[model samples]
Target: MNLLLNLILQEKQRIDYMLERYQEELAELPKGTIAEKKVNGKTYFYLKYRDGRKVVSQYVSKRNLEDLQKKLEKRKHIEAMIQSLEEEKRIAVKVLEG
Candidate 1:
């Protein structure tokens, strides 16, 4: 039982560190979703996100759209990992307590 408890404690620490790192990465990555608009038969992209109390939309040129989209996708993946780590940490804590 003691060995199992020690392992759980170690796993909890690892999860905590991973959660912190993922959160920091998430903060550095781009935020918001891409919005497509058609104007005069030409399609354009915009990066739409909320700023404070207002919704902000910034035009994204074709050249930068791919890079921006990649960054947004990375951000989403990291966010999901953070959530999973949090849940794991919660379970670890529950195990430690019991």
Candidate 2:
């Protein structure tokens, strides 16, 4: 039982570490126009235009950049949690079998 518990704990820790790494990658995404907008306050962030038509770069705003950063952080945290849980499960299984 003690071995099982220890395995679960170690697995959880490993998962958490992987998740943190994933989040870090997300946070490091290159800065660019992720979206666009039009006159009249209408947003058009998904579509990209090369010439003609007014298009606002979504990543151009400081607020958007900040929001992205926050999102990245939040995602990273969640991922870490998920990894930890998965590792725990794996370790539990191994211990139970052995």
Candidate 3:
């Protein structure tokens, strides 16, 4: 019971962090993967993502790749945190039940 309670608190904290980031820090970030293609010895970048069932691509300049990468990494981190919180919640519930 003690362990479960602690786990619950930890999960709550993480969820709060995720929400705060999503609302303030990363609110304007578009969802996509940074994809690169090379043509005849030159490299070009694009932000690739899915729209329903179709794969859409948005062009990105070389100068913007670094910023895009940072946003992508931050988005991934937030997603991982949300997943972790969900798992923790499930485990805590099971522990309390059994």
Candidate 4:
């Protein structure tokens, strides 16, 4: 049971590390230019840039950012849940032995 708990802890740490990497990558993206477009009767965000030829990223609106945030939160929540379950299992093993 101790061994199992240790493995679960390691997995949680790995996911946390990956999440940090993703956040850093997102932060490094250029601000570029902002444009508004109506799609499906809702305004959406678009980022445009020029090097030699113009470049545009697909719409990345506030709603999209919020959705990403929610996903990250869910990932973290799962990691925490795994850790909690591992602890619970360890405790149960101890109780049964006693």
Candidate 5:
């Protein structure tokens, strides 16, 4: 039926959009944590990440702290959106099949 065809096309477009967004959002992720250390009343910041079994760290300037945090949050949000898209794809597939 025309309705089913339209539904499939709309779902396909939505999936394509989500996939493109996923790829773009991946670049926004900088998977790491900002850590602080205090030494002799002086404070220091480090960006912490994992490499296999070992943990790696690098210095993060105070000026860049906010930017990194926003990137991390964006990455997390994208991950959640990807999961939601998976469910949408499943339903769409089922609809197409039935």
Candidate 6:
């Protein structure tokens, strides 16, 4: 019983550390989606996102579109990870309390 409690405590510590690190990483990641617009037989890409109460759209050059898309996808993956970790942490706390 003692060993199990120790393991749980260690796991809780690790989760806390990882949650902080993931949040910091998330803050640095870009937040937006790629939107394409057609004009005069040509397609242009834009990065669209909300800024406060207003929506902002920034034009994205073709050369940078792929890189931007990858970053946005990475941000989404990190968000999912953060959510999972939060749930895990909540469970860990409940177990520790009992």
Estimate, for each residue in 1-98, the C-alpha lDDT of model 1 and write its tens digit: 99999999999999989988888888899899999999999999999999998999999999999999999999999988988999999999999999
- In order of listing, the candidates' clash counts read 0, 2, 0, 0, 0, 0
Looking at model 2, the pairs that clash are 35-45, 36-45
Ranked candidates (TM-score, high to low): 6, 1, 5, 3, 2, 4
- Runs of candidate 4 exceeding 4 Å displacement: 1-63
Measured against the true structure, the TM-scores of the candidates, in listed sequence, are 0.94, 0.38, 0.68, 0.35, 0.78, 0.95
Model 1: CA > 4 A from native = none
What order do you get sorting by lDDT, best first?
1, 6, 5, 3, 4, 2
- What C-alpha lDDT values do all the predictions have? 0.94, 0.57, 0.77, 0.60, 0.84, 0.93
Which tens-of-lDDT digit does each residue in 2-89 have in candidate 2? Answer: 9767766677666667766666664564332345457588643432324455653333454465576565456556666767667666
Q: How well is each residue in 1-98 modelled by candidate 3, as lDDT tens digits?
A: 78767777676677666656655654576788988899999999999999999999999998888998988998888677767766766665665566
Which regions of candidate 2 fall more than 4 Å away from where they truly are?
Answer: 1-60
Best by lDDT, which number? 1
Candidate number that wins on lDDT, 2 or 4: 4
Q: lDDT tens string, model 6, 1-98?
A: 88998999999999999999989999998898999999999999999999999999999999999999999999999999999988999998999999
Of 1 and 4, which scores higher on TM-score?
1
Regarding TM-score, does 1 or 3 come out ahead? 1
| lDDT agreement of model 5 with the native | 0.84
Indicate the worst ten consecutive residues by lDDT in candidate 3: 18-27
Native-to-model Cα distance after best TM-score fit, residue 26 in candidate 5, in Å: 1.2
lDDT of 5 by residue, 29-81 (tens): 78778899998998888889898988999888899988988888888888888
